[model samples]
Target: MGTWNEGAFDNDDASDFIDDLAEAPDWRTVIQMLDHVTKSAGYLEAPEGQMAVAAAAIVAAAVGDVAILPDDRRDLKAALGAPPQGAVALARSALARVVAPASELDELWQEGDDHDAWLTQIAALQTTLSASQ
Candidate 1:
């Protein structure tokens, strides 16, 4: 995980995921990424958690939570339009998984001095996602 900060798209995997979405902006891609994280049976890798965060951010943006998104990605709100209710639900689940036990992303961050900051960012995203529900 080439993470530089706590923002959703501030890492290599997340940036790559967003780039893929930009190429063919589809809601299914967002939901699929979220599902990948939520359905993982074992420890969730850092890269998967990163991408799931990015996907959840997109779902939040799609439902008018653009303020929770990075500036460059705010346009995705228009590109993605509105996500289905299921995607919104999945986004919340995916985010919970990203911060749950066995999540490499969470484990790694917990070892850092900025873990609280990262958790705050996730919480903000979750709050934004919840508002859309």
Candidate 2:
């Protein structure tokens, strides 16, 4: 498919993206999804825009090793607009289950982390996440 564009489809909402991230069997899949969403949202330059905000929150959550803590998730999702839709109690269910390989990020990504290197990292994490399963 072509690169993502806003309003490309009726159900191309952030929730679907979020669910994709949560259901990603491995981090490689997660990065693929993130890259698609981020590229579509113009890297969140439209910070308050719906899709960008959602992608930003998920990136922050991943960098911060987020779990589905209700309070924290509430703040993240609300920042985008509203709350989760499914079973209220399971709002953060998928996120809560994420077990990152290491501690929270201490610094933002920078140069040297080129596209190829970044994909390599994602591939490695794919192995890690898959192995963990």
Candidate 3:
């Protein structure tokens, strides 16, 4: 099983660190990590609340980079636009939903079964997303 950054989803300090990374213009590492988390979330099975929670966790880590800004920040928008299609887009969308400041990741996590379906979905999404790139 892949190890998750449990602290990132459960604590403020870890979230702050992730937030700082997301804010950096050169966020390659952050992006890659988010990508990984996206794949992980996709694997979550339906009715499995943790899927959303995992997605939310990943999104929270990179929301600063993906969030839409006012017209003044066109450059930021262009740089962080959604992925074209397939798993990449799906992953991006899932992450976007989770990190949306108003989202409740803990709630989602608390609502689902711990099945391997999520892992499968994430693996497929990861393969498709990576191949597309």
Choose the strongest candidate by TM-score: 1
Candidate 2: tens digits of C-alpha lDDT, residues 39-99: 3422222211223323433543443334421232434433433322321112122222111
Over 1-133, each residue of candidate 1 has an lDDT whose tens digit, in order, gives: 6889899889999999998898898888888888888999899999999999999888877775577667776787788787977997899999999999999999999988999999998998888878877
Q: Model 3 misses residue 6 by how many Å?
A: 18
Q: Which of the two candidates, 1 or 3, achieves a greater TM-score against the reference?
A: 1
lDDT of each: 0.87, 0.31, 0.38
Candidates in order, TM-scores: namely 0.94, 0.27, 0.28
Candidate 1 TM-score to native: 0.94
Estimate, for each residue in 1-133, the C-alpha lDDT of model 3 and write its tens digit.
Answer: 1214332223343344344434763434334544554445343332222343333333322233333222333353345344323434545455444443333443343344632443443344344434445
Q: Between prediction 1 and prediction 3, which has the larger lDDT?
A: 1
In model 3, what are the clashing residue pairs, if there are any?
42-122, 43-118, 43-119, 43-121, 43-122, 44-118, 45-118, 49-112
Model 2, global lDDT? 0.31
* Order of candidate numbers by TM-score, starting with the best: 1, 3, 2
Best of the two (1, 2) by TM-score: 1
| TM-score of predicted structure 2 | 0.27
Sort by lDDT, best first: what order? Answer: 1, 3, 2
